[model samples]
Target chain A: MQTLSFQFSAGQPAQGRALVGCVGSGDLEVMLEPGTSGTLAIEVVTSVNGSDARWQQLFQRMFSEQQMPALNISIHDFGATPGVVRLRLEQAMEALADD
Target chain B: MNDRLDQTRQQHYQAHDLLWGFAPEHLPLNAPAWVVEALQVEPPVVVRRAQGTAGTIAVGVRGKTRDQRFACWMPRSAVSHSVQPEQLIEPGLAQAHRDWPLFKALALLAEPLDQSGLRWGVTGSLGFQLASGIEVIHPASDLDLLLRTPQPISREQAKAWLELIAQAPARVDVQLQCPAGAVALAEWATSRSQVLLKTQVEPLLVDDPWAVEHVAP
Candidate 1:
């Protein structure tokens, strides 16, 4: 298991908690919960080992591009492809936005 | 009266029967150990299938407090009544099965289990999407299945099932249901000792389902 943690600046606080995706082959599970601080904290647990740098780069790019709110996101990945990971992250943010 | 009894006998329960009995709080202290244990996780609503005895039905109990799911058996006599899974499945999954190729393929693969007296249902993100009408399934999402079987399966049988399921176009996670409870077939086949099983109350690291009883602390 590979664990990576990062924090990013966000605009506002999210109201509710939402969970998206499942940790399966070529997929991952993302859980978005309201955070205490004003920043977005992301922690990822992936089956793909030795990809910490790639994960960090992907998350940093996503945070910089998306106007996300203050939330705590936890991802459990089961060898998800980059495209699938991006999609799940977007869906998790969308779910938080809907709330 | 004989005809009425015959009609009732001929009416076998199908997959995804939602059975309701006395609430957990209302069950007597002396109720069957399994029933009491199962009620502690989910409510009395049991998802029925054709996997148990004639008078008993299989139910899938999912824990709201934890990431656990259990396959249990309950006596039909105790259940006040039951309903179909269609009533529980939201419209999203039905619509997706028609429009999405992956879900459509999953439906096709699952279609044969019922005929073999083994019932199958989705339980992971796809199941959540079906229940909540949410778009939780991604292009690479796996098809996690909760399989109900009439009896305990041997390691060889479990391995055969897994090999068969792995042939699907997408990744497939199959949880084999036994008389006592359910455990991932992969774990059951591979683990030499202490296989982790999702029981009605909590997750237990036991040698086998037969050893899973009163696991809660």
Candidate 2:
């Protein structure tokens, strides 16, 4: 297993914490909590090693296009495909909005 | 099909069929070393639901480890023998494996499955062992099953099926092969929003897997 962290500039902290997806089902599980007012942080625990660059690129590609609230995100990844990772992140963010 | 003259019509090979006589030479030139070495044993490849070229069928070669699977296409003509998952579990075909937790789960599922009358079949390690007698199943092996669903079943029906499957001694995973793709039976039963539909090319989280058109990404 490998753990990687990333930080991004962000808007105000999200109003509430939220969790989405399930780790045991071969999908990425994501948990989001309000973070420092101006920073977004993500910690990923992945079963696949040597995927640091992919995660970096994925997060950069995602965050560059849209602005998001400052939140601490914890991801438990079970070798999920990039699509699954993206979907779970979106799902977690949406769950936070629904909270 | 009786009046059909199209010779190139693709032959139907469902997911989980064990196909024999696939030549290693047909594999891509840059195939992984492990894939080439695994084929040296001449194991029957398992048919996958992925789409392939007109004359080829998508198949996966299994190696020793969980990460050793390699997907490739094999010409239809290269398939000399085919055994469907249901065929492997025919009453007299399987050697007695009752002591195995996997088999115990299958035994527990038999009566309800038969009574339900859904077109279901075995798959995964247990099916592999039964088909080839390779004994790949371990003590902790989960019983994997495929439920063929040309017509979408109600969520209530899927929930019922899940409850029945949950009674097994071991964990069970059931995939519902809808007309378009496959979805986990558990997700279809339980998910409040969209469920993940596994198509040949990609997985799409869709509200209805049985829909006619998918917004392919």
Candidate 3:
């Protein structure tokens, strides 16, 4: 498995933790926890290699403009496509927003 | 030509079916090294679902590991041999590797699965191996199954099947084949609202997969 790290600038820290998705074929599991002030840290452990740039592009597309709360996100990915990754990320963001 | 495959008159290929006789030099110009090598190894490429193009069908090449799968399009006319999960069911049970978790689980579930009366069979790694004798299954490889459920099954029925599947030595992933598309048995049994429906074009989140009308492209 390959582990990728990405950090994004953010707003205030989130209050509660949220988990979404699963480590299944063509899917992923994302866990969200409140992190240090003004920084969103993400670690992705993925089964697919040579996907660092794809993840980078996806994250940029997702979080480029929107300022989400500071959270530490850990994703356990099992060869999910970018579409699936985006879907799970959106779900995680929604869950965090609900809390 | 021993290609008496049980397919529709339209020759609609479903995901996870294995197809042979593709031109290896037919990949996109920028195809990766591993993909080229894997195709040269001459394994039957697994059929994949994607938006339909005029003459090309979507397929994936398995490169010995879960991480080594590559999705690409193949010319439909290039398919010399095709094998579906239905045809592999017998061979999967007849294979002598019951000591392996995947085969063992298949053996354990065969009777009950037959009794359930669901048009079910093997797919994924185990099915690939059984069909081609290429040895794609490992000890931890999941037993992927497809239950052709044109009629929507009750959540209770899905739960019951889940319980039965849980008894197997291997992890079983059963995709319920609705008229529209497919959904995971675990999700359909447990989800309160929408579940993911994997269609040929894309995955759709629908309350009832069977209720959705499949639109052919």
Candidate 4:
């Protein structure tokens, strides 16, 4: 059960689609697209299946912690741990923050 | 033993000071001060008056047998000896060792992407203070790695690397994420892999977007 989620807010769409990448064996890729929706959404795809419950717990924890606004978040997970997921999620937020 | 402990403690303090010096305000919230002290260690080395090698110490880890211990050292006393602390002995070193398997694993499995084009910088434990805070010498913890790859990362590569490292050793944990894409990746993975992988991962924001640094008045 290795999943992550987050969101951000912006007055308008970002300059470009925020892209999060990985290549460290076992990990998946990520692409975040902004939408007309006021709130941002997050998605994750991982190789390790059958742990949605755990993913929900982790996502809920992070979402409440960050209190982010509106944005679409996406993830491709191979088998990453909570820590790696955390870092990657943070990286994505930071990339969006830059926008 | 006391001297060894003191030296180890000094190394610990040195790492702490260095980390603070680099990023004073922004510290790893969960990481404790003692944890850093525990992992900061001196490679086993003892300088001898008799040897008179300009006070350069002979460092070596002890072994089950004296013969085995001696074998780990250089053939010649002055031939430059380096001691590798056992995994259990130090937390920081242990983390480095723990990460070795996965780092190497990624190197072996990853589709060859020429990093030469990328403005790649492998910074962190490998630098000075020589501490990654993953050793058992004091309080052991997880491994931390920062990879600022050349170009922006692709979604496919991110998930692949994450899964690969996570499957390495159960007790050990590995994280490979872009400094910028952490948050977005978290959101994206939620819907796609929400069932298993995404649930376990937690991503966040890095690179200090605020630029907290400023000049003194």
Q: Which candidate is the best by DockQ?
A: 3
Classify candidate 4 by CAPRI docking class.
incorrect
For model 4, residues B1-217, the per-residue Cα lDDT tens digits are: 7655543432222100122111212224554453234323522221110111221222222222111211011122232322221111223333344345434433433232223232221212222223333222212222233333324445566566556545543222222223222223223232232211211112323332112221111
| Model 3: CAPRI class | acceptable
* lDDT tens readout by residue for model 2, A1-99: 789999999999889988766533346678899999989999999866677999999999999998889999999986677777887788777778788
> CA lDDT of B86 in candidate 3?
82
The true-versus-predicted C-alpha distance at residue B168 of model 1, in Å, is 0.9
Per-residue error (Å), model 4, residue B135:
32
Inter-residue clash pairs, candidate 2: none
True contacts kept of each: 0.05, 0.05, 0.30, 0.30
Q: Which scores higher on DockQ, 2 or 4? A: 2
> Could you give the DockQ of candidate 3?
0.48
lDDT of each: 0.61, 0.78, 0.80, 0.37
Best by lDDT: 3
Interface RMSD of 1: 13.0
| Model 3 lDDT tens row, B143-191 | 8898889887999999998898888999988888887777888888886
Off by over 4 Å in 1: A5-44, A47-99, B1-93, B97-101, B214-217
lDDT of candidate 1 over B53-102, digit per residue (tens): 45556665543322234455666677776544333333344564454545
Error of 2 at A28 (Å): 4.8
lDDT at residue A20 of model 2 (Cα atoms) = 66
Q: Which portions of model 3 miss their true places by more than 4 Å?
A: B1-11, B91-96, B215-217
**What does TM-score give for chain A of every model?**
0.90, 0.95, 0.94, 0.71
Q: Residue by residue across B109-215, what tens digits does model 2's lDDT show?
A: 87777777767888887787778777677888778888788887899998998897777788887888787677888888887767777776676778888884532
